[model samples]
Target: MLKKDKERNDAFLAIGNIANSVKSAIAPYLDGVLIYVREGLSVQSRKRGSVNPVFDCISRLAVAVGQTLSKYMEALLDPIFACDLTPKLTQALVDMGFYIPPVKPTIQERLLDMLSMVLCGEPFKPLGAPQPNTLNSVPIIPKDAKDP
Candidate 1:
């Protein structure tokens, strides 16, 4: 049996962190994860609508893939939308020292703000790739030249 919700949440997070590190490895497994997501969300749907950690893992995976998730939208969108997020969003703002706005912004605004934040980050700098040793490279001499 799956563990309690808290335990399942931690497991979901671990899988999501793996997704963040190796997204290419996640595509083939998307269907499986979607199954869990749908099931988890459905369970949450039957509750009093407390924020669920399955949603957190979904966010993590979405961030890892960006728009690549579009292809799976048909399977994902409904259960996601079926769950109410206002409480979670309000809690997030409160935690961040924000006052809830008089009117909730549309979902597009929230999504755009998230995308903007990501796009505004400092550009990624690659860890330097392997380098061939240069100090040990001897100069090649032309057959006709006395000096290398």
Candidate 2:
């Protein structure tokens, strides 16, 4: 039981770390957007309607945060694939009617991919592979050689 508890705690901690990193990266941007939206709404004095622009902006931000959190959780939980709980969590989110957006490749995707590659001991597929070195690539003359 203690071993199981430790494993669960470790998993939660790992997820928490990823969440914190993402939140720290995005919080400032979200805050700025919120302030901008609020000021715009106040200045325009737009009447509240079926589609609340302010709420929509807030909802978008919340969705972004939620998606980021889920991606991090998925990456952390991936090691224990057999015991994967991401699907369940995703389903729960859907059932709760949360605004779960489609998965789009972002910086988070790249980071998680790199992390997965490192953890799996797999070779990274660089965006552009470097040209192979050849004999001609090396300096033909010694560094000490001077102009004849």
The most accurate candidate by TM-score is: 1
- How accurate locally, in lDDT, is each candidate? 0.56, 0.39
Mind sharing the TM-score for model 1?
A: 0.52
Q: Which lDDT tens digits does candidate 2 get at residues 1-148?
A: 1124344334334433443456546654544443443442342323321113233333334444755433333332232222212443334233213533443233235444555665776644566878568988877866656656
CA-only RMSD, every prediction? 18.1, 17.4
Candidate 2, overall lDDT?
0.39
The stretch of ten residues in a row with the least summed lDDT in candidate 2 is: 76-85
Error of 2 at 13 (Å): 34
State in Å the error of residue 65, model 1: 2.1
Please write out the lDDT profile of model 1 over residues 1-148, one tens digit for every residue: 1547566667676767887788656867877886776776675433723335666666666656554555665565556555545554334233222221221243334444444556765333335945556866867756866657
TM-score of each: 0.52, 0.24
